[model samples]
Each structure stands twice: as C-alpha cells, then as structure tokens.
Target: MKPAPFNYFAPESLKEAITLLERNHGTSKIIAGGQSLLPLMNMRLATPETLIDLRNIDGMKQIREVNGFLEIGAMVTHQRIMTSTLVQEKCPLLAEAAGHIAHRQVRNRGTIGGSVAHADPAAEFPTVVTALDADIKIEGPGGEHWLKPAEFFLGFMMTTLQPTDILTALRVPVSPPRCGWSVQELARKENFFAIAGAVCLLQLSQNRVVDVHLGIMGCSPAPLKPLQAEETIRGQELTDDLLAKVADLISEQVEPESDLHGTKAYRRAMAGVVTKRALKEAHHRASEGRQ
Candidate 1:
C-alpha cells in the first residue's frame, strides 16, 4: 500500500515548519526521521494531506549541556545517542538502552523525539526518559512549552502535542553521584520489542536506598513508574526478601494486556521478574561506586 497523495515540505527553519503546520492544521503531519510515519503512511494507517519534514531544521540535531542538564535535540538519532561521549559520560543509562533499539539500521535513522513521539509501549527511549525524569520541549503557534514525560506520553502512540506543535528537544538531569542504572527486558529475540522491560536507577547513601526510579514498559498503556515499589525501597537497606516483595508488589499493580506475543499473565509475571533483576543490578553497580 502507498500513502495517499500529500504535499511535502522540507522546511529549513523551525519557524517555517510550524507556520506550515499551522496553515495545514488538521490535515498535516510532522516527519522527523520518517522511520515510523513512513511505514504508517505506506500502510494507509496514517494519511495526511501534507507532510512537514523537520530534519532540515538546523538546531534540532545537536547534543549539549545547558543549565546543568543535557539537552538532546529532538532529531538526534538513536545511534548518535548510543555513541555520544557526553551522553555516555553523563547518562550512560540512556546510552546503554539506546543499543537495545530495533537494530543498527533503524537506530541510524530513528530520532529520539520521533521514537518518543511514536511512544510504543515497549520502546526503550521513552522508558529511559521517564526513569531519568526528563522534560520534553515543544513549540507551536503558542510559542514554547515543556512537559514531563508523564504529561507528554498520554497513551500508546499518543501524546499531548497539538497538530501544530513540534517536539524540539529533551532535557535530562545529569545522573548524580553514587547513582547506578540498569535495563532489564524480556524480548523474544535480540532487538525485538520487549515483552516486558524494566529500567531502574538507584542512588544509595551509606548502604541505604536514598532514591530509586523504576520505569516499566510493555506492561501498560504507557510507560509506568511503580511508586509502590519505589516507596517500599526508599531509605532502607536492600535485602533479597525485600526485593522479592517489591517485585511481587509490581506484578500485582501492572496492567498487562493479552496479546499475540504473550499472555497477559506471562507479561505480568515477566514485568515483576525484570523489575527485581534491574534493581539487583543497579544495587550492584551502586556498590561498585564505593570501590
């Protein structure tokens, strides 16, 4: 299948891009890497009267530090993040998770903002950003606005972005001292979508849990942060039994859907298992920080 006839525009500047979007309004769609939208368009699942390509916009492709946070351009590809020296040094968790994306072929062309905008429940970048407590920057006729990951990702393949809005960048807080991060996912095969994935960030103080972020994927409509699990482990020394309890708690709370990849029961159980594994690994890394 091929996409329906549509006018295409490669705008050189963001101001021009948003102007085109506003003029096209309900009949337009934004294209970043075209990794996701192109396929959908080919399938006729998404047919827009106009397609606005953002790749030509100059400032949306760089990664730099600003005001104590790493500001990643929306057009930054997965492979770029995977290899970026700054990303590796400041947010290695994101760097590691980027390697788990579909494949080198896709990573070479898939933009971080595009993936987050695509918002597949099992996607690595969205879950990583959520765990990192990142902020999304968007621009439109109304000028600029920032959204939390929770606020930005409203549902699977859905976001709060208006038709005229462009996702410009992501701002991730630099990982703190003594912070350990890990990604544990259950996938049918390497680079396949995760059946269930857990991204954990653990910060320890004197052998007690100072803070923990548990970002879950493939078990709910949107990426999740299991507050119960975080609350249960905070300010306490991690024990095997306690980890088990936290895992069980997450299993009971996640809402997995029945699907062809696996049964809801299977995904639900795997979600818990990955959560425990991720937390355990994070703890190990944090301990190594002491050495």
Candidate 2:
C-alpha cells in the first residue's frame, strides 16, 4: 500500500527543517535516509501530514573525532559505518554490528539516526550505543541539548524528543585499550531482525575484567542494560562460571513479550543464550587483544 497523501519537503538547513516541523504542529515527521520511516508510511502505520527530509542537510553526514569521543553524525549510513577506517579503528564494535544490518541496499540507505529515532528493540545501533554509553544530540526551538542513550530512548519506538526537535548526531567514547566487544543475535536469517540480541564490551588487563558493559535488545520495549548483572562481574576474574552466572542474572532480568516471531519464554531464554555467547566471544577477543 502507498503512504497517505502528505506534503513532502527537502530542507537545505537544520533551522529550516526545525521551522517546518514547528509549523506543522506535531503532524510532521523528520526523515533522514528513509530506510525505516518509508516502510512504516507504506504500510499506513505512520501517517504524518508533512515529511521534512533531512538528507539535503550536509552538516549531519560527518564523522569526527573530538576530545576522546567520536561524534558520528546521525545521518551516517550503516554501509559507511562498516567501511570507515576511523570507525573501524576507534570503534570496531560499531563496524561489526553495522555489518549485521539488513542487506547491502538497505545498509546503504539505512541511517544511524533513523534507526535510533525509530527505537526498534531488535536494532543493533541502539543496543550498541547503550553498551557504549553514547550520547545523542538534538536541536529544537528551545535550542540544543544532549541526552544519554537511557534518557533519549523511551519504550518501543518512543523517544523524549519533541515534535520539533531534530536528533543530529551521536557521540561515543573511543574504545579503550584491550577492549573486546561482541554482538550476538538470534535472527531467523542473516541480516534480519533478531528475536533476541546481546552486546558486550569488555576491557581486560592481566586476564581480569577492568570494565564491562552489557546491553540486550529484542527482549523488551526498549533496549536495556542489565546493570546489576554487569556490576556482578565487573572488576572480577573472567571465568566461564562467572559468565554463566551473569547470563543467568540477565535472563532473570529480561522481560520479553510474546509475538508471532517468538514466544515470551522462548525469547527470554534466547536473551540469556545470546548474552552468554556475546560474553564468551568478547572475552576471547579481549584475550587476543582484538577489538
């Protein structure tokens, strides 16, 4: 099905886009790469009266390193993320995860911003950012502000963004030395959405955990960090038994809904499976000094 009739706009400037959004009074949607939104519009799941395109805005398509953090423009495509040498060297977790997104064409068109804004629980970027402790930048009538991943994402596809606010970019700290990260998912097929997924970041020194971050997706309304589980193993010796313990803690903490894709019990169980896999892989990578 085709989308409902709506005004289409390609704004050349961020200010212009914000103005158009404000003028529309909550009936407009800001579009970046059109990878996620177009599908929703096509299915009539979203019916915004005005579509304010951000693709024409040049400022939002950059990757810069500043003050120990990588400021990745929201418009950065998944394909680009997978290929960028800087991202590969400084934030290899993002590159690895980007490679798992839907096929080539979709990755070329799908954007970090659009995915984050869409807030799909199964999406890779959201869980990656959560584990990385990333921040989101936004601009609106009230001016600019930044929000941590936890503050930016609400349940499901919801966000704290006002209708007139434009999410401009994401900032992530550079991965530390001896850092090991892994993305594990239980997808029906390659490049498809996961029934349950887990991301793990581990920093190791002398075969012990220096720091660790764990984030899980596809098991809750929003991607979540099982903080208690992470803390349980943080600064502790890395062991198979410890990993299993952490995975069990995460499984007990996960809350998945029953859907056509998987049963709640099944997805919840898979969450622990992925977490254990992710933890093992990450630990191996850390041992090998790979990131």
Candidate 3:
C-alpha cells in the first residue's frame, strides 16, 4: 500500500529542521535515513502529515571524538558505521552489529539514530548501544539534553522523544585494552531481523571476569541487560558449567511475547543460547588480549 498524503520539508540546517518540527508539532515526523520511516509509512503503520528530512543538514553526518568518547552524528548510516575506521577502532562492537543489520542496500540507507528511535525489539543497534552504555543526544524547542539508552527507550517501538525533538548524536566510549566483545543472533534468513540476539562485552583479569556488560534482544519489549546474569559471571572464572547457569538465569529474566517469527519459549531459549555463545567468544578474545 502507498503512504497517505504528506508534506515534505527538507531543511538545510539543524536549526531550520528544529523550527519545522516545532511548527508542525504533533503532525511531523523527523526522517534521517528514511529506511524505517518510509516502510512504516508505506504500510500505513505511520501516517504523519508532515515529513521533515534531515539529510541536508550540516554537521549531522559526521564522526568525531570528544571528551574521550566517539561522538557519531544521528545521520550516520549503518554502512558508514560498518566501513568507518574510527567506528571500528573506537567501537568495533557497533561495526560487528552493523554488518548483521538486514542487507547491504538497507545498511546504505539505515541510520543508527533511525534504528535507535524506531526502537524495534529485534534491532541490533539498540541492543549493542544499550550494552555499551552509550548516550543519546536530542534537541528540541526546549533546547538539548542527553539520555542513557535505558532512559531513551520506553518500550517496543516507543521512545522518550517528544513530538518536536530530534536525535542529534550518539556518544560511545572506547573499549579498554584487552576488552572483548561479541554479538550473536539467530535469524530465519541471512539479513532478516533476528529471532533472538545477544551482545556481550567482557574484561578479564587473570582468568577472572572483572567487568562485563550483557544485552539481549528479540526476547523482551526492549533490549534488556539481565543484571542477574551479569552478576553471575562478573568477578568469577567463566566455565561451561557457570555459563550454563548464567544462560538459565537469562532465560528466566526475559519476557518475550509469541509471534509468527517464533514462540515466546523459542525466543527465550535462543536468547540464552546466543548469550552463551557470545560470552564464550568474548571470554576467548579477552584471554587473547583482543577487542
């Protein structure tokens, strides 16, 4: 189905885009890549009366480092993230996750901010960013502010953004030396949305886990970090038996709903499975002093 009639406004500056959004109020949609918003519009899932495009805005497509963090503009595409040396060096976990998002064509048009704002339960970026404790910046008529991933995501396909707000950038801290990260997912096809996924980051000291972050997707309303599971393995020597126990803890922590892609039970099971695999690989990389 075709999208309903809408007015298109492409602004050349961030301030202009913000003005348009404020003027349109509740009727406007801020579009970056249009990869997600276009599909939703075409399917009648979203029918905004006005579409405000941000592609022409300056400073919205940059990648830079600030205050010891990699600050990525909201307009950065998945393909850019996958290819950027800066992203690869500072946040390799993002590159690994970007490679798993749909296909090349989609990656070329899918913005990191778009995916995070879309907040799809099965999306990889949100899961990875949340696990990394990344910060999101937003601007509106009221001015600008920053939010942690948990504060930004409210529920499935929902965020804390206001009607006149635009996501400005994402700030991710560089991983420490010897830190290990892995992203694993189960999908029906090579590029389809994951049925279940896990992102794990670990720092091991003398074979004992010192710091760890765990995030799971496709098994909850939003990407979730099972604190119980993290605590289970943190500061402890990882073993098959221990991982199995942590897997069980993760399975019990998630609250997934049944759908055509997979049953709740299936998603829960796979969440644990992927988490175990991710943790194992992360442990290995940490042991090898690689990130």
Candidate 1 at residue 180, lDDT? 87
* TM-score of every candidate: 0.97, 0.98, 0.98
- Residue lDDT tens for model 3, 58-133: 8878899888788999999999999999888877888888999999999999999899988997898899888888
lDDT of 1 at 179: 82
Q: What residue pairs are clashing in model 1?
A: none
List the candidate 1 regions with Cα displacement exceeding 4 Å. none
lDDT per residue (tens digit) for residues 24-74 in model 1: 988999899888899999999999999999978999999998887999999
Put the candidates in TM-score order, highest first: 2, 3, 1
Model 3, residue 183: displacement in angstroms?
0.8
The 10-residue segment of model 1 with minimum total lDDT is 282-291
CA lDDT scores, all candidates in order = 0.90, 0.90, 0.90
As a whole number from 0 to 100, the lDDT of residue 85 in candidate 1 is 89
Using TM-score as the measure, the top candidate is 2
